[model samples]
Target: MAKTLLIGANSTIAQALQENSDREFICLARSEGNLNLDGDLSELDDVTDINGLVYFPGTINLKPFTMLKEDDFLNDFKVNVLGAAKVVKKVINQLKESEGASVVFISSVAANIGLPFHASIGASKSALEGMARSLAAEYTNAKVCFNVVAPSLTDTSLSTNLLKTDRLVEASKERNPMKEIGDPQKVAKTIDFLLDAHKNWMTGQVIHVDGGMNNLK
Candidate 1:
């Protein structure tokens, strides 16, 4: 049984992944969850030979660049980048022990596509993309693959503010070429595919599950 570690296990996407996934998952989250990476991951002391890891924690701070403060960027980076970094660092050795380990970091389409009021989140996710690519290169001989899944405004709790009103939802849908927001299940499936042993040949790539929002007009 391949073991997988999931940070922010309470997230909607993580929940969806849990429901559909067959592999064993060591769920971690803050407060009352299995483990809290914000403090220490000693709970992972017994965990060895990790086959996959997925970081699901993220922030949605959509505001004009001028209106954003330094703390906003710092907070976004803490959750989106630093948090993932901490978990990955804690389990890198365990991941390397597996036959074909895989790491998937969840990012946003805003990282690649320029969108209004996405300065902080975009910057943070962009850093994540760069870090994942570099890690893929560094771990090329470890038989471990690193990749990113960039999703557009999925209907998750983190995006409730953006899709709160019917008017806002309709406007967002119109902006996407697919005429719809991303589904958590669909995005989870993409993550699962990348984590599967069959995808050993793919790495250092950003797979967009973003309803045609990244490339389409």
Candidate 2:
């Protein structure tokens, strides 16, 4: 079985991957005392020859543009963008060692759509997508695929506040063309497909797994 590294492993989508994926996983997250994206990555230096890397660390800083302080932007960038960058850089060589290695980053529909009060998260996710595309371009020749999964309003612990009330959830569902919030398992399945060793041909793409939120509506 292929070995995979899952950052922010406690996240709902990462948990979905754990429950559903066949690949061997090395989970890293603060809850397990395994990772701090801002801290040293020396702990993972010995984790090598990884076939896949899925970065799940992200921020949902959805505050009004005027309410967003510079630190809010910096913090969002650190979590959503720089954290993935750090982990990817740390294991770039390990991923290259394996055949058809894949790297998956979780993005957001806000990265493409102009959603109000999503300034911080939107900006950071957009940067994350750009970085993924550039890295994909750099590694396509090496057979190391990098791709992104952008979802919108998923029903996860991370989205608790947003979907607190039935009315809020329904409102969210109504806004999307599919009349539903994103499912973590469904999103995980998309990531699984991208991580498939046999499906590494596609690169430099942002796969929207949002319930038609990125386009139709």
Candidate number with greatest lDDT: 2
Q: TM-score for each prediction?
A: 0.95, 0.97
Error of 2 at 5 (Å): 0.4
Q: For residues 4-105, write the lDDT of model 2, one tens digit per residue.
A: 999999999999989998889998888999797778788798897689999998878888899999999999999999999899889988888786789999
Query: What is the model-wide C-alpha lDDT for candidate 1?
Result: 0.88
Give me candidate 1's TM-score against the actual structure.
0.95
Cα displacement (angstroms), candidate 2, residue 4, comes to 0.5
Supply candidate 2's per-residue lDDT for 92: 88
Q: Which stretches of candidate 2 lie over 4 Å from their true place?
A: 197-200
- Residue runs of model 1 more than 4 Å from their true location after superposition: 197-199
Give lDDT per model, in order. 0.88, 0.89
At residue 8, give the lDDT of candidate 1: 86
Model 2 error, position 86 (Å) = 0.8
Q: Which ten residues in a row have the lowest lDDT in candidate 2?
A: 196-205
